[model samples]
Target: MAPAAITLAAEAPKLSSANTGFMLICSALVLLMTPGLAFFYGGMVRVKSTLNMLMMSFVSIGIVTILWVLYGFSLAFGSSNGFIGFNSDWLGMSNVGLTELWDGYTIPIFVFMVFQMMFAVITPALISGAIADRVKFSAWALFVALWLTIVYVPVAHWVWGADGWAFKLGVIDFAGGTAVHINAGAGALGVILVIGKRVGFKKDPMRPHSLPLVMLGAGLLWFGWFGFNAGSWLGNDDGVGALMFVNTQVATAAAMLAWLAYEKIRHGAFTTLGAASGAVAGLVAITPSGGAVSPLGAIAVGAIAGVACAAAVGLKFKFGYDDSLDVVGVHMVGGIIGSLLIGFFATGKGQSTATGVFYGDHSFTQLWKQFAGVGAVLGYSLVASAVLAFLLDKTLGMRVTEDEEVSGIDQAEHAETAYDFSGAGGGVVSSVSAALAGTSKKVDA
Candidate 1:
């Protein structure tokens, strides 16, 4: 037999049960991060708006799940134009057989579908934090539905789908630096600009109501992020997944320290909120570069993102847009750092063969590609989100009444309260009033 014939005969692709099981578990883990996000955001809002925050995240799971199966997946990953994927054959996954495996992928087609579905669900939910406390729940839902279709689906296709414009152009987003983080961040900015600021933007004590809840949510996110980063490889056979997992940990740890150090130098206090925010910033920073960069590179990315995001969070104060929970600062800013720095830090040794400028490859080509990917997603998401928010605002009305917002969105929107501390006693009521008065006095002071 000729050598070529022997080589072709020696290579056979078979489905591995182990890879299937690993991916299924990874899908489940990624799904958990959405609820964890609910807690993280819920605790940041006032006690009254807590359930609404949680509801915002929870509702994405329900809405996006149905949409993803019906056609969202097709629009995102179907075989079609490079800029966008929309094949009727993939509508409702009709063309996908249960026994079918995605080409060149080790897992079943359905498993991969669900995994990407989880990502689609959470991307829009990340925008909710920017407009917390004052948004009408129904309007927010409508925005999510529209934004996902117009902005997220196209961007997801561009970055991830086979033959995607950016994918073909050599952009390297191992996870979701552009598609998820920058997309959501810019979308949040657009919606917030349309919705305007919370009633008390600069003057109120909008401090987190419960640090414990925030920490719990952060812990869940940290645990689940292993899957979020490593699972992108789609297979554990290569040591790339292992490297991603380690990079995720060390980057997050470094970020937390960097944020605390910054806070101590600037604000003179190391708040629990800083630790949690730093951890999330780190996670966002490493998502794109973790598999491509070394542990030291991860640390550098995380540390830069931590400090940059910490400072960026204050931009709302300077620019006078109320990003209620700093989603723009952490997700968007950290994402840009991670995505762009990969242009300098990526080693040609990893799964990605592209070498960075700093790796002595001495070319800015990869850097320009990164910028193009980020710019395309950011610009598209921003304009699409603004249009959606404006349409929703014009029709359904996006914000609650001023009275409803001041009193609390939970009762006005959900007809429920997060805490029933009202029924405690007469003494408790007086004490609580006095405490609030004292807080107001301090704000004035």
Candidate 2:
């Protein structure tokens, strides 16, 4: 090779330990979200279904990790015709080099691969909340595998892949509002539509068994979301990641307050559930727009999503499709609100040159593009997910027996209960008898 060519090759971006370390930490943080989600969903269900709810989220971590290593990464990030991607070398992550950097970034290909894997892990886990108590565990696992392959991989390619149609069309999803939130939310809606409602739709008094667990889960999700939103930039070379970090906090706080206010006005009380749900709504809304909008814009996104999602939760009752945990209300609606608001809040200054309607060179062009991205993902996920659920419901039986569901899916499905009431019963009786004996002795004295 000529000297000039050799020089140019040698000058290629070298490995950045700083960026690699940042991403590794970020990857760990993202992985924690699956467990966080487990706690969040687990706490929201009846005591009879708590273990099942937690397992649904936990299972996705195992299933998606294997798939992502095998061919999921290749199909998602490989070069293709803007729909799906495949590179044989990346099929098993076989040909990737440890020193090789992802194109346009300092992090290694493996780091990027694992980082994306966490995203894949949690997206399907998000759907489990909707079908909580009734679905068979085996059927749910199959759905996760198929949905990740059929629905998530392609939609991810569309929005985040280099040659993706949505990427090429200039859709601004800084994180995963369209690909993750909307996709999961729509998929939840579709599956529930097919599987029908939980046995006692209106008459049963199904309340959350544990609010403390719910609060703990929400706190974890909030803590991990900083990495989820900021680390998308791949490096801290610029201040964009920092900006995203700030926006994440601002938006979450704003959404929480907005939700509490709305609850106080509408329900006449400030409930803890509302606070947790509202914070999550803010997180979802700001996920896509944080990189493109200012802090104030993030506040707008969070507040709007908080109220909209808070109100949207009621739609399940009105429409009569049983979304046990309000996935449709919070994630789907919040994702749409966040993605579309980017067209109005984007300043063309933070992460991209594209401007929103309320920003420089105000135009509706970005808004239309946002619509296209949202509509395509939502429509495709809705249809494809329903079809997959229908096939599974017909073949393997998606739901447990009605008796199993009414009694407790944990025992029927996993052969164990979340709480051992037999021991508790004995303890309670012993205490009552001891107290009665003490009272009788005191009276004799």
Candidate 3:
């Protein structure tokens, strides 16, 4: 007769009604980040194509949302082959029950479905920033539609889904360090290579039109990220889940501070973009380790992300590649930093148990796994994305005509303006003058 079996499981740990509500709330909060991202990217481009950027994200909601309901979830989460979900028969989930694991209080599968669909939607929209100011809206829509079918759904299934090949291979991505960040970062690079540099790129100084808009976008992204990290806990445990929530907030704050501090020390004035970008860098870094590591661990991850991402964004200068929106800099660099540094810090220590350099897993092995995951995702993503881009470029064409890019897509494609302040003033827009504006700007369209 023993007093107890004495184990982490032996303790009758409990989840709360309040916690359940909080998680559902968090899911909704994260879903909002897609629109927030739209604003973030939309505001960075020149006023000429502002609405186009906004629509990239919004259209994702329409395209991916419908696709997810049809079969995206089955391809992603249904029990099946590791590479691609073999249970295409589960397409509509004709007889599926709610999502539940050995752990209890699992949210309704439909709730989980919508939350993840938002993630799928946003990942492609993130790339639009790299190729903005060009890409015909119809072509962009078709690309996202097709890219989702090819690149995104398969990668997501391989990374996070239960039957995912990467997960089966024992790769750990707590919250899309590889799936969302690496896939998108590398995919952006492949497209940029084919799409070519921004017209004025290094040859002309193309300043961000609105730093305030950038900062606004960043603030919303940070606020929404708590849901992104904490909602992954699905079980709603206090000790582990609570730790993740606090870590997400603290790491973001620290990274933001570190970034502004770096900017102030180096550039004499802390720009809004620096602060906003810092927060995103921190959020991306902490994403992978949030559920499994501690607050202190989060700090190290955030600090490394801040410094590394800041420097990575400057790589375009040295490497001579145009990652137009710093997707490579922030997501790729930060994702790697977080994935690897966790190897050194994720110890199963008191209060923050997980095992890392402090423990005896030896940083080398853990670090290698991180790099292996990165390389695997990168290599696969580059080839696959290049193929997709080539097909699109050759068939329907992934790029806009030089003339269309110069004239801007909003007027030429949509025949609409983002803000009709002029309309509010009872003034009609000058179609001929707008037409002249498009054709006269170093373009012959």
Candidate 4:
């Protein structure tokens, strides 16, 4: 009997090289998004603070990676209570075997761990755009560490962990509409409220210094989001990953067009910034719903989010919170729209077994469940992040001095500039001299 039991265990599903390879590629794609995000946010700030804006996003890569390896994975995914998780063996990834499968999946636990680490990396980075240009780099770093531990970890557990209350309740989050988008958006709102507004909020032009750079960043984000959305399925054994991929592209296109239309109607012109922002809004809206809805449903989700986020971005000016980059408008609003729309568009055909309000049985049960998940994450992240920012503000000081802010955060904090104008005059002089010298040679010849 003992021998037979050992043989049965040995006969369990083996590691799939295809899925493993696919996931590795997906992880790399997701990792690229942070730097892409850096460019996106960096270009939106004034020239003086470009590097600081980029640094805020880039630093999250370092901060979250170390924490994830140390204890974040365990706290997020370990089997424990529904609220939070902890496993002694997974603390340092000490006992996770190289070939050991991730429970019922064919991929190794290590592969899944690294893939998830990418998600953890980007979530905090999303919040950086909200508080850009005025934050102390050290304070922001500290906040990332603390927020990941206290807010993100538990929320991740509650949504994705096996025994999590939300997971048990059948709330469908294919990727991270709640855990990543809403959580980061709400956290951004909380911190910005505490840190106060930038130096010249409504008075300053404060326009994006480089629209081209913003477009580049948005392009990269759009490309990498394929991995972020599809990889959440964990493998290609099923067709759900393919479905997510198609839906992502469709929704993004629809949203971009929708946003441009709205911009033309509201602002009288379709701006490049509007196109980029609209695409992002679409991405955020589809992150959670892509797996559950058809391509048509994705279009609806994307179109709605695009117009909604386009309108929401203006609210900061009206209410005066000063979210530097519209993280709340795009991410929070988009995420909530996507997550809640899941209750309407889910066909019980794609990833989950649950049908939405407009589908089979026309039940509102899933809608209520989604409300629970969104409310829980939003409420907790907002309150807890505000508290964390307040504590950091009191002790280490979250904002730089007004003088440093006016002088520029890149020079004050990082001692570097995104562009070096000091050498521009010299280069111009050198170029004119070379051109004259070439003309002289030509005449002599």
In model 2, how many backbone clashes occur?
0
Write down the TM-score of every candidate: 0.93, 0.94, 0.86, 0.94
Candidate 3 vs candidate 4, TM-score winner: 4
- In model 3, the worst 10-residue window by lDDT is 1-10
Which scores higher on lDDT, 1 or 4?
4
Top candidate when judged by lDDT against the true structure: 2
> Model 3, 1-445: lDDT tens per residue?
0000113555533445565566578767877888888888877887777888889888988988888878887777666677777455446656555542112333455556666777788788877887877777877888787778788888888777676767666555677787788788888888887767766777866567777778778888888887887776664545666677788887888887888887788778887888888999999888876665678878878877887788788888788777767888988778777777767777654223446665577646655666677788777776777777777888887766778767776776678777675343444565655666778985854
Residue 17 of model 4 has an lDDT of 98
**lDDT of candidate 4 at residue 412, scale 0 to 100:** 94
| lDDT for model 2 | 0.92
List the candidate 1 regions with Cα displacement exceeding 4 Å: 1-12, 422-445
lDDT of 2 by residue, 1-445 (tens): 0000112455677789999999999999999999999999999999999999999999999999999999998998888769998878889898999888887677798998999999999999999999999999999999999999999999998998888899889898988999999999999999999999998988899899999999999999999999899999998998999999999999999999999999999999999999999999999999999999999999999999989999999999998999999999999999999999999999988988888988854559999999999999999999999999999999999999999999999999999888774453657666777788899999999
For candidate 3, the lDDT comes to: 0.73
Prediction 4 global C-alpha lDDT: 0.91
lDDT of 4 by residue, 307-408 (tens): 999999999999999999999999999999999999999999999778898896455999999999999999999999999999999999999999999999
Candidate achieving higher lDDT, 2 or 4: 2
